[model samples]
Target: MSMFDKTTKMAAVLKGHPKAKEVLESFGLQCSTCSGAKHESIELGATNHGLDVNELLTHLNALFDEPPGK
Candidate 1:
């Protein structure tokens, strides 16, 4: 399973990924718990949040490159 699958909450994605959080917020996603986020996958969220999906995908993949708990 992908790291994304290992977690059930958006907060988990950012727990060890401050850079990724910054990137997300830069796209105006103030909170993963925000209503809009509930209906969007991170990929879709990035698209609708005014982010460049390709860039976000690259960054997010990098964030997960290191094993968790490192």
Candidate 2:
């Protein structure tokens, strides 16, 4: 299972994650400047922006994947 799933909140993902913000931008999610953007879930944001939730999760998880030997 991925650490950050589709139901994960956008703010939580972006928090302390500059790379996440960049990835979201690359995915064409421009909600950072909008009201309640931080409160939106990943699925909600992706759906509202006409993006594929699974694909977005794939990209996001890649950016935040945990390393082995932890």
Candidate 3:
């Protein structure tokens, strides 16, 4: 039961998780300011950025375990 996967849209991820921007930035993805974030899926972004999609998803899903303001 992961909170996000390859098909998850960047916009949806940002909206769904409070720390998504931070997490994304850590992986070198400046999604918050990118227009493509509106329609780009995690998989696409990762591929375009030369990142490992599975690694990104792992970090993104880890956010689900944190307390709401952490």
TM-score of each: 0.50, 0.78, 0.93
lDDT of 3: 0.93
Per-residue lDDT of model 3, residues 1-70, tens digit only: 4789899999999998889899999998999999999899999999999999999999999999887777
Cα lDDT listed for each candidate: 0.58, 0.79, 0.93
Which stretches of model 3 miss by more than 4 angstroms? Answer: none
- The TM-score obtained by model 3 is 0.93
Displacement of residue 66 (Cα, Å) in model 3 is 1.4
Considering only N, C-alpha and C atoms within 3 Å, which residue pairs clash in candidate 2?
Answer: none
lDDT of 2 by residue, 1-70 (tens): 5668877888788873557787889988765676666679999999998999999988888765655532
Q: Which whole-number lDDT from 0 to 100 does residue 12 have in model 2?
A: 82
Off by over 4 Å in 1: 1-20, 66-70
| Among all candidates shown, the one with the greatest lDDT | 3
Candidate 3: residue 60 Cα off by (Å): 0.3
- State which candidate, 2 or 3, has the greater TM-score: 3
